[model samples]
Target: MKPRDLFVLVGIIGIVLMMVVPIPTVMLDVLLVINISLALMILLVAMNTTDALQFSIFPSMLLITTLFRLALNVSTTRNILSKGEAGHVVETFGSFVAGDNLVVGFVVFLILVIVQFIVITKGSERVAEVAARFTLDAMPGKQMSIDADLNAGMINEQQARERRKKIENEADFYGAMDGASKFVKGDAIAGIVILIINLIGGLIIGMLFLNKSAAESAALFSKLTIGDGLVSQIPALLISTAAGLIVTRATSEGNLASDITGQILAYPKLLYVVAATVFVLGTFTPIGPTATYPLAIVLVISARRMQTNLSRKQAEEEQMEEEQQIEEVRSPESVISLLQIDPIEFEFGYGLIPLADTQQGGDLLDRIILIRRQCALELGIVVPVIRIRDNIQLKPNEYVIKIKGNTVAGGELLLNHYLAMSPGFDDDSVTGIETTEPAFGLPALWIDEATKERAELASYTVVDPPSVVATHLTEIIKKHSYELLGRQETKALVDNVRESYPALVDELIPSILSIGDIQKVLAKLLREKISVRDMVTILETLADYGTYTKDPDILTEYVRQALSRQITLQYSDRGDSLKVITVGPSLEKKIAEAVQQTEQGSYLALDPSSSQIIYHRLNEQVSKAIQTGQQPVILTSPTIRMYLRQLLERTMQDIPVLSYSELEPSVEIQSMGVVNL
Candidate 1:
């Protein structure tokens, strides 16, 4: 239950209890007892007492009726040696013995208050914790949500699969770590009991020095006053404060935050200080009882102000940090704007001017002697000219770039046909990725989501000589850098992306979990090209190194195909098995030349599952076997999954359409040591 509602319920119960019970002469005493009990319950909850039994009315009832009654009985009987009332003090106790319940009731009420407070706050901190958590999530304090509207079609197979993997991993961690900050123990009742014991014991001790007035002195022994003889026991008060502090901290350790100043918050020393300050100031200064009491109340309540200020400061800093990150995403092109520059006229020489001698002719060129470095991409980049503005150019290629409003126009003239590249921009100068900040936009290169992500990844790597992995990789694959790479280079590129970057490895894991689903997505979007065997390698890599959020079913289908492919290749290539012939491109031809770099004689991106094969050039016999329903593994230029599916579908109609199930499972791994994904 919420704290306020719980308080209201307790209040109503207190009223009913007071009215229901018949207390003619002892009504005031009974009311006070009920009030104490109500306060105890709230104290237990706010202090976060976790024990159900203690919180229930059973403990409260026992304390009020038993402990409170006994304490009150002893407390009301005083040693009245003061004002010559020694004789009167004796008469008061004697009257109490004559069965007068009014005096008896007063003593009971005080006892109940002390006992219940002790029981409730003894060792539980749940009350404090609930209050803290609910308070943090208070209204108008939550961060704005950015629920991205995902486009299934626009994402393509690679992105959706990767994003899902990362999200699922974070969700699992959050569910487990949610309880890390909760308090373990906070017992306010124990501190109260210690105080009560000290109270009762101190009176007994004081009775030795003072005669009939000892009882009065004990009741207010540690209490502050405005005159002499107020506290004859300084040592006793110090001990009581120290004991209360130690006990409170021990009990509240679990629920209370370490950041809280224990000495200031729950430490009993603070209460002692306030009481002492009041007594000393009241006695020395001209302060009245009324003013002194009010000051004490103010000091106690204002203790929490410092903590509030600290929390506010931390929140503000975090918000500022978030805004700074959004602002940092601004693009360089927009930051360096040129007033008037038309790219088209310069590239084609439309606004022609004959050059004196050979002044590079309208194009800026740089002959950069490349440095040998180990990283990723090593492409020639366009460097912008300072102050002169207009016309940004790259090395060797005389190109012109122009920006008029949103349109980006650029053309690099080649020996043959003119090459063209155009991408647009917006007011924020942000290229085109959706961000948490609506105030900022991205640059042109980042306009495409995939490219933007790749650019971020590139910042961490040193792209000098770049990895030789992709130098000759364009010819085999069909996308951006595909035309420039060969088969070997293609495999090398995949290996590097999968293994070198921890983030990339983590991102690929979820996609690999459901191998068949991912393959299908790849096939549909990427032109139907990859084989089941290749998909298996991707899946196995994910299982071994990536974080998989789904069940093992993701592994079954793909593992089967990979194993089947392994068996087929292994059996055909074995020495004793019937002669094997690899039709069309040989294994050497299929593997890219760039990837042939010696890594202990194994293929750079070779799936450990590779088997021996007797390669033969494509011949008429291979075509006849394919037509006659004899299955043979053929190696060729890499094609997208969708295109491969179409080619295989046509082949199935002509042949018997043998299932890949024939391959053996053991051939998948081949005992080669596992490599990092």
Candidate 2:
């Protein structure tokens, strides 16, 4: 053990031994002084603490001090009864208090004991009990508040954990104080009982053993008993007061002294009223003017000085605030702060404020939270916090969604109307205003509440205004999710997977492929609307084929083939049949011949005339598939599948370009048409 710990252990052992050991007078006096000093220090420390938890160890300290005081009482009682003298400290206290009378000293000691036991200790015990009960009751609410803040992005994980720890510490501290207060009460009772025992026992020993007279024995013993009681009770009273201070302390920005002065003396004008009251009393009563007038004048003068200082302080504060504002405006960091952009921002006009205001019954914020969770589940990427704000530059009832500081999609809404989209047919009677469905570009109408039931009855899909915004926002986020997946976000995903598949992650990263290479592969997958939630499979595939090719497109194709079942289920319709437009052998051979290889990678280098003819043929087949109500999926051979996708990416970005290798054997393919050159 360290020296300090050993010292504490030896000190506790000594306190227990003090009851049995015969202490010398000089040593006893020093210990008595040390006890009083300790009590004073405790009281001072309690007063200076701004929060109860700052003095968390006080409960255990209270028990130790109480035990030590009891031990001191035993030793002093022994010396007084047997040797007729306790120590110089006790002798000084006896002479200083009683002088020539024993009754006064005894009466004073009883008063101290009564005050400590009944007043300070009793009140502290009750306060501690109430504080502990209230703290326990509030714990659940505090915990929930912390959770809400965490969910709202108001605090990070580390900050949330720290806040939760603080709450638990507060609960434990108050609970301990509740039990510690009882020790103070018991100590007070013990002091009184010990005093009575020493008095009676001293009287008997002084007469029988010292050959002192009855009166002499009573006088000597009474003085000694009262002195010992005073010495012990004084410290006990200080300690009890400290206990009261600790339990009653509320959280504050300053210590007890500053709070008292800052709050009680907050209004200096109150002193003027007191000054007037004192002057009136002095003038009306015959006993007063000479003594009261001087005090009243001093109070009035002090009040004036305080008022002047208060006014000057306010002026200085205002001036400092103005200066700080000016300095901030001139700072370079102010301009730099403006340049930073949010990853995703939802800006709306003033008229659409009700959609986001909670007090106005808008659930947009709550809806955004759900949208983020949905994106994470569907796309396997954490969506950044969407910044929502009102932009006066836009028309009222208009909203825009921006990705990385650029507006990508926008729409206008009628808050009091429902958007009704046609179900492959229109209802003439279920119309209010002409509009287009923002999410899917379908023809829709803004119908009022009166026409909502009519539209629903007419087989038209109906949704509220908030639903419209939510659908649009969710689609836009998913469309641009690839842009949000940078190195940092990829690192977070890798770290998360490392927790479960440490060996797999360790073997794959920085050896077979770096994070940038993995990010490129993942981005390609997201761009094609693929979910990377099956990370273990994705990582295993990368670890197997990553050594052969560092090209993201090639790796992506391999991952796609490995995830054939998932892709098959994603696009397959009823009866497990995939209806698609197939690429013919002539075009596939032409594209395969046009593939140009370099040190960097492969690219499609077909001539412009051939590309135009190919686009013309591809569009005709895609249109034919759409006319038949089948999604336009182009099925090509695995060798030129990625090259075909690269050719059609800019024009047919939304279309699924699948290869034969990316389909399951159980899935049957039904070709609608063939694209040929």
Candidate 3:
């Protein structure tokens, strides 16, 4: 074992032995001195720690020290009652410290016990109990805050994990302290009991066994008992004080002394007022200049010195900050840094700043965080950190969502109004400014908060300014999520999957298909608004089909076929028939024949007239499906699904095109409309 480990083991064994074995007076004195020194050191360390976690081992230390002191009390009591002496340390405290007065020593010892037990120990125990309960109660909130920071891109995975661990550690520390405080409390009671036993037992032994007179026996026994009590109680008092200091200490940049000096004495005017008060009291109470004049002079000088130091520190800090700013501006690296772009950028005008600012009751940042988490869970993609800031160039209340420095969506909000959308029927009674919903371009009205109840009564969906922007951002992210899933993100997903499906990930990646191939396949799924959260299934499908073809589009079709049940469940309401728009067999055949396969991939080679006819027919069928309150879904043969989707993507981006093989066998499909060219 290492030296420290060996020393700790030996020390623990020796502490246990102290209670059972009889120690010589010299060794007993040395142990007593070590106990006092240890207590003093603990007190000093507790006072100097800025945060409780800094001394996380304090509870364990308290237990060990408390045990050690109890053992010492036992050994000292044995020596005093048997040999009429305990140790030099106890003897000295009995005679010199107590002024050779047994009554005086007993009173002082009793006072120390009372202070430690009633004041410091009791308060520390209560604080520890409350701290433990509060820490445990706040754990979930702290965890959520960490998750929010992680989702907001304010922190990364590693930092989030570290923060969570720290919070757990804090909870554990407070709980341990709560239990450890009992040790100090019990130690106090044990001290008083030990004192009484020693005094009573020593008297009986001195009078009967040693054949001494009552006065001599009383004097001798009282001195020894009081001395031993004082020796034990003094260290206990120090430790109790240490416990109080630790539990009561708040988080700070410095130790207790520095915090008090910097904060309490930071204001020199308070000192000036005290000096004036003292001067007035001295003048009115017939106090002489001999004492008050010098004290007042000292207070004034100290106040002036504190003011000078504060001013100097503030000036230095400002000058240093200014220099740093100038240096950054002059540095070439600062200019080069502007070339970098965030993956996502959310910019807003001055009027809408309150929507993103936490201080102004803006939860837009928090909302964005939830949006990212929702995307991750729903779409199975890690959305990048959204950098939110103000853009003065934009009009007030205008906000823009950007991906890769290009604006994808922008909208204006009336901060004091709610955006209300009719369920279906028009509600002209709710007078408001007519506007298009930024996410879907549906007709909506910006109505006053007073009309919110009326709008709700009219069966309209109502949302606040932040919710409006958040909805638009959420839709924009869903639409463009494929572009954000780069090769690195794909590898990260694979690495995560490897933990559960190691053999499958190994067989599919690098051997049959590379990371780029998987990225493309996953991106294709995301493009169609399909979640790849079931990575095990997706990878299993890829492993089965990947050896035959390396084409991502072909591979994506296989994976989609494998995920048919999930897709069907997503689009179909529970226990409801799947309503869909289907292409007529003639059009499907014509489109399938137009698919020309090349080494690069397959492409549609239909004539412009034929393509135009297909587009017109498909648009009409989609419109008809929407009119019947059915979601627009295009179903076609598996071979032509990709081509058909590519053809309709520009005009029918919102419509989902599924292949025949992508539907579950158990699902009942109801054809709403058919397209013919």
Candidate 4:
């Protein structure tokens, strides 16, 4: 063990021994002096600590010191009653400090006890109790604030953990102080009891056993008892004062002495006023100028010096700040830093600032965090951190969402108005500006609050401005999610899968296919609005069919066929048959025959007139399915699904094209319409 730990163990053992074994007066005096020194050191350290938590061990120290003093008292009581002499240190206190008068010595001891037990210890205990209560009560709020800062990227995880640890330490320290104060109070009472017992026992022993007169017994015993009490109580008073200082200390950057000096001298005018008052009191009042005039002159000089120092400090701070700014401008890193870009950016004009400002009760940042988690759950991809800022180049009520430094979607919002969309019928009765919904292009209107209740009564869906922006951002992210899944994200997904399906991951990655190939397959799924959350099946299917073909499109078709159940459940309602649009036998045959294949890829080798005829027929079938309240799904053969999707991608952006193999066997399919040429 280290020397300090060994010393502490030995000291505790010695304290227990002092109560049982009698010691010589010389050794007692040494121990007595050490006790006084320890108390003084504790007081000085407590005074210099910047915060109570800095002296976290002080509560345990208080208990040890209090026990040490009591042990010393027990040893001295034994020596005085048995030998009529305790130690030279106690004798000196009784004679020199109390002027050799027993009554005076007893009175001084009483004063020390009252000051420590009544004023300092009692007050410290109350303050500690309240502090502990308040700290525990505020812990949850402090923890939440730390979490908010972490989410907002103000502090890293390590910094947040450190701050939370400090808060916990503060609470524990205050609670310990609360219990430790009682030790001081009990020590004071023990001192008083020990003194009385020594006096009575000393008198009885001296008169009855030693054949001494009553007066001599009383005199000798009184002096020793008073002296011993004084020695113990003085240190007790110092320790109690230290406890008060510790419990009452507020958090500050500097020590107690410096904090007091800096704050009090901050305003020189206050000192000037005090000096003037003192000067007037010395000149006009009955009090003479002998003492007051000199003190007033000293205060005036001190104030002038303080004012000069304050001015110099302010000038130095301003100069330092200016120099720092100039250095930052000349630094090469400042210009090079401009190349960094946020992966996602949300920019708004000045008028819509309140929608993104947390101070104004806006929850846009919080909503953005939820959006990221939602995407992770639904799309199986991690969205990048979005940087929100105000751009003066845009119009005052407009906002834009950018993905990888390019604008993908933009919209306008009215702060005091709500956007309302009709369920189905036209509502010309509502008075507002007609606009299209930014997320889906559905017809919508921006109406005032007065029309909100009326619009709801009219069966219109109403949404606030922030929600509108959030919804638009969500849709944009969902549509362009394929562009966001790079190789890094694909690696993360593989690592996650490795945790559960280690064998499957090991066989597929870097063996049959690389991370780049996996990313392409995942991106293809996302482009078709398919979720890659079912990674086990996708990886398993890829492992089975990956060696047959190196193309991502072909690999994705195999994965989709393996995930037929999930795809079927996604589009069909519960307990309802699947309604789909199909191509006629003649048109399907024509398209199947038009497919041309090469080593690079396959392409449509159909005539332009036949392509036009196919596009027009598909549009007519899609329109008929939508008019019948059916989702526009085109079911085709597996051989032509990719080619047909590529053919209709630009013309039918909202329609989902599926192959017959992509459907589950349990789901019943009903053909709603067919495209014939």
Candidate 5:
């Protein structure tokens, strides 16, 4: 242990020994002075702490100081009764402070005991009890708030853990304070008892053993008893006051002195009223102007100075804000900040500010939170925060969604109207303004509220302005989620999985496949609108086949086959049957033969003429499926599934290209159409 720790240990042992050992008068006097210094230091430290946790050791310290005081009382009582003299410090306190009046000395000592026991000690104990109870009761709510912030991505895991630890420490500190306050109350009562013992026992011993007269014995014992009582009770009073300060201290930005001055001086105009009141009392009351007039003049002058200072401070603050803004514009860091782009941005015209402003009753911000949560559940990736702002250049009703600084989608909305789409039939009576749905490009009309109910009754799908924006934003995020998952995001996902399945991650990462390779596979899956939420199954398949092949495209095909059940459930209607366009053998063979292989990877190198003819035929079948109100799912063999997907990716990015092996055997498949060449 360090020397300071050893010193504290030895000091506590010595304090306990003082009760039994016969201490000399000179040593006793020094000990008494040290006790007073310690009490003053404790009180000062307590006043300066901004938070209770800053002095968390105070409860234990209270018990130790109480024990030390009791030990000092024992030593002094023994000396006073045995030798009729305690020490120089005790004697000075008795003669100089009490002034040879026994009744006055006793009364003063009694008053100190009463003030400490009844006022400061009682209040400190009550405050500690209430604080402990409230802290324990608030623990669950504080924990839940932290969890909510973590889930919403407002704070990371480490910050949330730290906040939780602080709450636990606060609860424990208050609980300890609750028990330690009892020590102070008991110490007060013990001081009163020790006072009576010294007085009576000193008188008895002086008369019987020292052979002193009754009058002399009474005078000597009374002075010594009062001196000892005064010495002990003064430190106890300081300590009890410190305990009160600690238990009542609230968490603040400043220490006690600063908080008092800053808050009390917050309103300088109120000082004028106080100054006026002081002048009235001084001029009219019988207490005389000589005493109060000087204070009143000082108050008036101070109020004037404070008011001028307040005005100057406000002006300085405004000037500082302007200078900071100017500096920011001229700084090189400003240009660097502009170079960084948000992953997703939703910018609207000034007229649509109400949609994002909470004060205007818009739930768009809340809707975005739910959109991010829904995307996490559906796409299995944490979406970055979407930056929202108002753009002055756009039209009043226009808003746009940007991905990585490029505008991918935008639309116009009429705030006071609802967009109603026809159910394959036009409703001429329920129309207002014609438009196309931003998300799906369906023909719709912006209908007013008067026409909303009528349009609903007429079998039309009607949606308000905010819902339109929310749906459009959600679709854009889902479409561009693949672009957001880089190597860093992929590593985050891997770490999340490693927490639960360490061996699998340990075997696959950097051993069979690197993070970039896993990222490519995940991006491909997301590009095809597949949920990688089933990370366990995905990683298991990669670990099983990763050694044989390192190409992400081929590995993705293998993972697809492993996730057959999930894909089957995704495409099937009612979880029982699937209807799709089947690729003919002739077309499959033609595409398979045209695929070129090199050291890098494989790619389809079909001639321009053959590609055109294939595209024409595939489009015809897909149009027929869509016209028949059926989803255009193209089913092909496993060997050419990826090549065919690459072939159609540019023209038909939304169509899902599935392989025969990627479908479960239990699901029934019906061929709606076939593509042949």
Candidate 6:
């Protein structure tokens, strides 16, 4: 039988037994007598409630059974009492336990018990459903947060599951404390004092003034007065000890059985004390075990209050920590910074394109090299390198990496932290993510499949394409003709479409989804027009993906700047010689003069001789270097200009596309120390 059922059964039988047997005059106003049974039933219900408070059919059945049992016992007792004459409840009722009356009353009790048990058995599922609904409906916010974490690759599927469980457990725990507190409220000391006084006075008064002649006195004497004539206090002691055990179990760490074990071991002394106390109460002196029960109830409720508060405090702290993590997504900059790239020599960008006619490498390597060449061409720089596969082979002007999404873990940072914390489960050495570049590992990962599944279940539909596309862009491009298109190409595409056709830009699917629809206007610049002005616009909008856009008018002002510039860098190879030069407006003769002096594997400067070329000031040195396939040199601070320079420099090296939007050209070098060339 369930502990709850046992509690109700014991309580009903004890109450009926009390009424049918006899009430000693002194114990007549025993208002607290019902407490014994009530306390146990609450504790039993509490045990179930404490373990799992989720919506479930069992709790409904359990609750219904408890209420049904109480109703039946109350009705039956009231009816049976009303049936008898004032004095003799069936002198037949007095001796009822031994006779046919006993058999009849007990059979009725058994039938009711069985009927209620069956109802509980049948209604169990509905009860569980109710509990589960209650648990889930109670924690929508926490559930949403868990879902978000799961979707964001902050936590895995299993961890999300465990987090939900923790939320449910906390809800149940505090809820039980509230219910238990209400059930046991009253003045504990007063009840204990009253029980002591009543037992002692009743025993002595019944023994001295009452005779065995009357039915009532005879009944009281038979039930309470032992053979030697002292009051029988065993029943009250049993109730007190049970109450203590139940309270200790609920309020302490030990399980019910453990509490019972401790009680049993301690009872050697308790038994003697109760036996002696029985005599004292019978002699009309008041003090003993019955008094202790009420006080135990008080202490247990108080302790329950304390535990609930502590758990709540812990839960709040955890919530704050989670909030901090979610906020950090402002940029993948942290991940990039941790990869150890120096801010001085290194630069990162977004939405930039590669120069098509630049250095030689496969389609992939070409993309990387072109970005650097573009950056170098735009800013005048002499550094381009690529870190792909596991080695850092030197690319004189370009390089590229082959990345497989399936093999890469999505929550690399989270995984790294987990490994740091747990010594037994630390196997994160296989991720070949790029950390050498300061901008490498820059939160550019796609939302994993695991994240999508979790978010879907939680009803957090994909709000942005990055919510679906960012994680697998690299993989998608590989399969779809989208090889990491040159940073400059991407920038140019955005510039051309956006400039050439704003509506066309709006209609064209974004080349990448990580930076979402919020960047719609910025993307259009690349589709319709290709120019320096459009390039700056693309750079300005790089890291805003996955976030809400707050400014619209400001974006338009920047697009015009990228399209107005008309400076171009040129390169060529003839026989045993390589030629490099810069050109703008009208400088064909200057380009020829510069081109004539260049040799294979050697560098030459392109001095723009025209007035318009000087006005443009596009990095002539960078143009020459990109054309000749040599490292470009740019004299710029660690700011937007520097970032632009770095973008082309690295593309010259071949890694991934870089853009003006990907980085800040801040002159502050505090966060980014110097880097060796």
lDDT of each candidate versus the true structure: 0.33, 0.93, 0.90, 0.90, 0.93, 0.35
Which candidate number maximizes TM-score?
Answer: 5
Residue 11, model 3: Cα distance from true site in angstroms: 38
Q: Give the TM-score of candidate 4.
A: 0.57
| Candidate 1 local lDDT, 1-677, one digit each (tens) | 99998996785565445433432324434433443454444443424432222223322332333333223222322222122121222233334332334345334434543443343322222333443344345412221111232442545556655555434433332222123111111122322343355445545545655552565654333221100111111111222222222223323443333425444464534655786699678767888667787777666556456446657877999999888756655645544455554311223232222111137342221111121111122221111221113333343333232222222232222222111112221333323323221011211221343343444443411111111112211111212221123334434434455665656444564454343433333232222222222433644544553354232222333343444544355444442232222222334333333243343332234333331122112234356555554443432223221122233443332211112253443333221111111
Off by over 4 Å in 4: 1-34, 49-89, 95-104, 107-194, 201-213, 239-343, 348-388, 395-399, 410-475, 484-523, 531-633, 643-654, 664-677
lDDT of 4 by residue, 267-315 (tens): 9989889999999999999898997999999999999999899999999
Model 6: per-residue lDDT, tens digit, 1-677? 99998996886566555544544423332322333354345445444332333322332333333333333223323322332211222232324432423334334433433332333222332333344456557699889999999987999999999888888775664444333322112112222333344335444455565532344533443322111111112122222232222222334555555656545633343444554545556456456546654554454554466456657877999998888877675567657655663211211111111212125212434445555565334332222243333212323222222222222212112121111111223223322222211122222222344454444443432222221212232322222222223344344446554675565344433542323332444333222222233333344443232123323223422333332222111111221222222222233333234432223321224443443353234444445455554633322221232222223332332211112232233311111111111
Ranking of all predicted structures according to TM-score, beginning with the best and ending with the worst? 5, 2, 3, 4, 6, 1
Q: Which ten residues in a row have the lowest lDDT in candidate 4?
A: 569-578
TM-score of 6: 0.28
- Worst lDDT 10-window in candidate 1: 224-233
TM-score of each: 0.21, 0.68, 0.58, 0.57, 0.72, 0.28
Better of 1 and 5 by lDDT: 5
Give the per-residue lDDT digits (tens) of candidate 3, residues 485-585: 99989888999999987888878878898999989999989998999899899989988998999999899999999998889898877625688888888
Task: Tally clashes: model 2.
Answer: 0
lDDT of 4 at 226: 86
Where is model 6 poorest over a 10-residue stretch in terms of lDDT?
Answer: 225-234
Task: Point to the candidate with the largest lDDT.
Answer: 2
Estimate candidate 2's alpha-carbon lDDT, on a 0 to 1 scale.
Answer: 0.93
Q: In candidate 5, residue 245 scores what lDDT?
A: 92
